[model samples]
Target: MELPVGGHPADKYQNPKTMKTRVIILLAIFLSAFALLPDRVIKGTVTDGSHTPIAGVNVSIQGGGSGTVTDRAGRFAIRVPNLARALVFKKTGYKSLTMPVTSDSVLNVALTQATLKTEELADQILDHSKQPGQAEKSLAFNRVAAAPATFSGAVMQMQVPTESYKPINENGFLSVGQQPVTTFSVDVDRAAYSNVRRFLNSGQMPPEDAVRIEEMINYFDYNYPQPAGEHPLAITTETTDSPWNPGLKLVHIGLQAKTVSTENLPASNLVFLIDVSGSMSDPNKLPLLKQAFKLLVDQLRAEDKISLVAYAGSAGLVLPPTAGSEKKVIKDALDKLEAGGSTAGGEGIELAYGLAKKHFLPKGNNRVILATDGDFNVGISNESELQKLIEEKRKAGIFLSVMGFGMGNYKDSHVETLADKGNGNYAYIDNIQEARKEFVQEFGGTLFTIAKDVKIQIEFNPAHVQAYRLIGYENRALRNDEFNDDQKDAGDMGSGHTVTAIYEIVPKGVQTSYIGTTEALKYQQNHVRATGDSDEMMTVKVRYKKPDSEKSILFDLPVKAATLAFEKCSENLRFASAVAEFGLLLRGSEYKGKATYADVIQRARAAFGKDEEGYRSEFVQLVKTAQSLDGSQETARK
Candidate 1:
């Protein structure tokens, strides 16, 4: 303090006391200036143009290097230094936004994804063409359209690629005299119904591959008798005139699993494996998924514990195992989730399985609830890879359940594969009401498995049935030898789940166009059934395993040659047949003979007994909507 660097000697000495006072004044001024420039906690959510939360967005005060990136929920809380007039939000694929900071505590921002100008897109395509093997990738971004676009007028509907489904090859009628037995796995999935409903509600016909008639019929609740004995399920069979083809008889086989009380349900260790990728930024995806999970949270018992794992570019555990009683804490974590980045679904699955394994509960319901649009692009994206991954994880005794969300780019084939291979059930959640139906009203059926590897084998009586064809389940048919193989995987049946399968059968003497005739085989002789079994239509054999067992138990039911008229059939049978007919019409099936929307409506209405829950009523209305969309006559063939 002898002499300041830039000060005179006289100035240093003459102001010993005065200089001290001046220094105090200067210190006070600096302290006051520092006090005026206080730090503020700026908190906000970053979303895209669709108002979907966007993660990994860079948020910072203007002219400041210090900033924070948004978490998976698109929320950020950063302390900003003084003299910052505005906040800038930046992300690579989105347009950078500089918003005025009117409030120190809160600022919600919406950013738009950066779309290339026509010229820019053209340049990118041109450049990509010069590079080897890049043409397809470039064209995917700028594909040819059916019509010229007026870009300034309205936003054109973008063509999002979807997984291709194999064409539906209708099951052919097998000769009862030649091949008396038909074996197939039971399918309890209801994705086809909800997905078809989505298309119809949007005034578009669903693709043929999307219309699984068996699933559509099974989607509705049938008042089938519950199991009265030791078996976990009850089987019932009924026959009536086929609504589409009157020449053939519709055989309805129903299996209803026994219901368990909520108190009796085992403690559940659930992992909510959610996809928070950019593709899930749509309202119907991540947002709807949140609401759906909230409903599920409400149904959780106090003993249940839940952990949440989110995946975007990579997977991360957003929340640790939280007691169901700490619902507020769980929901708060859920609320913080935001959608952005590429999808890494495979990583998410591995992480979810890891958590499920770590928290494995003996005799407890250990499961993972996967909610996604099925856009697994980043790591291990292909179906085979995913199936193998799930297959390996399934051996750990942890079950999985997939809830599909969103449209356009939905990967039904992928999600369906995961569910089928993972020993889980697949369902599509089209709306909040559907969510309530799955998570609240049918929670036990959707979450608790009572039977696994449920297979159905029917031995037709040659004396009664001339030929037979399963109406749907084209993808679920199993080889006769595989039906008894415990190692061969099949569909699972959940508690209180009702599965209905229909077969259009031709009586021994009846004539039909579906009958396939073949020359007599020289290598083998076909033995005709004796007349003593003339009254037996077929024998329904069901094989299933306990939830924890490897060996299967078998049950049998003998169906008679029922001649019940369509009008004389039970409401359950009639309604299920009507649904099958609707599916045929939707598919424009080759066998849809004399099927009209009017007839479908009439049959559905007549069978809409006890319209509790209004599900049947909704079906009737959906039929009317389809009628309006396709006209009075069936335009499905169009």
Candidate 2:
């Protein structure tokens, strides 16, 4: 018989050498299959270059059906098909990475941090034109993120109400009174320092009356740490001059609110304060609110309890406090709610608080979740009385969370105040996804309070800096004394919440100061503390009271490094800065420089981070809408 070279029946009858070759061939096949099986076991660790584990990173194989998120340790394991040649990794705040599978079944991958660039910021500002029915006089900005920096930047456009656009004061500050919306576009360069010092020293800008766009932007996203543990909160601030105008510079800051595990959250007591008034008869109003509530109902745990209250001319208990485990009962109550009569929001709130108080679970999550258009037309309609009632109820330890719905008559002012006074948070539910964000995705943080009365006080070293101004938080600004006052209630931060603020600084050696010294301050003798070290820029102090407590905790951090180059900041910080500038322009802020929509877009484009969700891209579209509205208004005026 002929000798076989590889595994064959003939090899049995062949010589010893042929038989040995046949055995080797069979062994090779078995080893290959074993090797393939090990590759099928996909494994990797999601981490930053700094060797820090990044949880919640999503991992999936290209063209494969299954995916998994990184665990608390930033480790992930998935069973992929043996045939798969590669896999992809992604996360919201981190860049997405795709890798080819190698012989080692175990893989260690480091994901680069996601950031926005200058051009990306610009693109976002220009893209805002796509918003529906954007008026010709609308104001808009572009937000972009950059690498290594934590915040984003914005480019803005101002639509001048009249042809004669001039600052009322010779100083940089714009007068608060009404001015014709002017169409002016300038790039707001990123600022290297914080603006808080400017506000404190100048006192030219009115407190409480002015609205900082950054605060409005940061307020809705409640990402405080969980009650169980400390969460890492990061913030970056930057400022640069307008690409179109050297005289103007924009300031931007980015904040990242880290989330803790939900394993230790306490059971919740949620009271639904629904508004089923005559105005809510539209399908999108009452019906949408009903649907939204149902979605929230689905997110509840078995240990959680819920109650229902409806208001129109009067308020009534639609459902008593019931266990979340009983879904059908809650759903039935929600289904039966009907809309009629004039809005009696005050009465509704009183009744809702009564129910919440009755069902209060000490040391547990107790909150009245109010859903309404914020229109109150019946008895006790005064905002002061309503504020007083909510403030008093807050003392009872029952928190308030407001969900704003509908337009045309939306009471942003009232809703904002109620949330602030009630030691809770507010959200605007324009769509189902937003509802999910507030109710489903961030359920624990939305309901529970890890920290309350959170406040930040940064004392800049006058030796290293000449002038500074806080970018936003115009309404939240506090006097140096307010920081120590436990009775003075500040902003309430929920679980896994992160708050960020920024300031623009004019270094001592800079040619000119954006903020001039006040007459009174100039006349007064100044005391200066000189530090020889140029590295120490400022000292940051953060103070907060634990939820349900009166005592405050304080933390101090020193900013020792000199100002970072404009290009060095991360994309997120750059993009966020653009957004701040745009917001300032929209509010007609006194500090707004030569910021414009086109400049905002260009900066956003350069710093556009890994925008998997397209939020940054959508912001660009909004800017375009604002620009079109501004142009049309100017033409009509002509």
TM-score of each: 0.75, 0.64
Question: Which has the greatest lDDT?
Answer: 1
Looking at model 2, residue 230 earns an lDDT score of 55
What TM-score does candidate 2 get on C-alpha atoms? 0.64
Q: Please list the residue runs of candidate 1 whose C-alpha ends up more than 4 Å from where it truly belongs after superposition.
A: 1-166, 520-526, 529-533, 632-638
**Per-residue lDDT of model 1, residues 276-334, tens digit only:** 98878766788789988999999888899999999999999999999888889899999
lDDT for each of the candidates?
0.80, 0.60
For candidate 1, the per-residue lDDT at 284 reads 71
Judging by TM-score against the true structure, name the best candidate: 1
lDDT of 2 at 466: 55
CA displacement after TM-score superposition, residue 588 of candidate 1 (Å): 0.7
After TM-score superposition, the amount by which residue 604's alpha carbon in candidate 2 deviates from its true location, in angstroms, is 2.2
